[model samples]
Target: MNSTKCQKCGLTNFATDLECKRCGTSFVQKTRNSGSRPKFSIIAVVMFAGVAAAFYYVFTGVQGSVDKVNSVEANRVNAQPVLPPDAGRSRADYDRYRSQTVANAVGVSPGLAEHANRTQQTDKAMDQMTNSRAQ
Candidate 1:
């Protein structure tokens, strides 16, 4: 029987033995191709593709919502008030007229309309007070 010398411990072993007796070194040459690409299972590939698609869908939906918000803001900025600018009209009168118009359009009861008008007046008074204090 041919004997092979251990590279690590220098102990001689039989050719038929799988490992060095003294050092536990494997004698069999590895047959794996080091240059070959790693294999991915079909399930792994599908999962990766699904994740990519989900991200794409989420990004697109977010972009669409952002576009809608931008469009709505643009419309609000560009919109003209129902009443024309008149020097004779007091700020209170203008607010009352605008609120009445809105109430008429929405078909609200007279009591609710009066409450809305009072709320608008209160808000305007508070805003004026805040501005005066700020100055």
Candidate 2:
């Protein structure tokens, strides 16, 4: 069989021998393969890309919803109350003026008017519950 030469002892040794038989010198070579990292497979790369894309999609969708909520809140905060010059002269006059303002804001449609009324009632109920709990 072909043999390997031991560098330290200058002795010929069998290729499978870990050390020189004559001087007991180690003949083992450190493998280069142990230091190299394995390459990523195509399936692993595709899975990572898919997860990243899903995260991006979810993030943008949530951000868009947050932006819409912020815009609506800004509009509500910036809205000016509509009132007549003669408003608040008496309780009855004030009530009529308030009703007119609400009607204008909620639209003239019967369905819209009912919806607005229900929303107002819901707000009142929630406020009552909160006040009661506070007490």
In the order shown, the candidates' Cα RMSDs to the true structure are 12.8, 12.9
Model 1 residue runs over 4 Å out of place are 1-37, 80-135
TM-scores of all predicted structures: 0.37, 0.37
**How well does candidate 1 score on lDDT at residue 84?**
65
Off by over 4 Å in 2: 1-36, 80-135
- Clashing residue pairs in all predictions, respectively, total 0, 0
For model 1, the run of ten residues with the poorest summed lDDT: 28-37
lDDT of each: 0.83, 0.83
Give the alpha carbon lDDT tens digit for every residue of 1-135 in model 2: 668787767888888888789988765542234346577799999999999999999999999999999999999878967656774399888889899988787796788889878999999999999999999
Error of 2 at 95 (Å): 26
Candidate 1 lDDT: 0.83
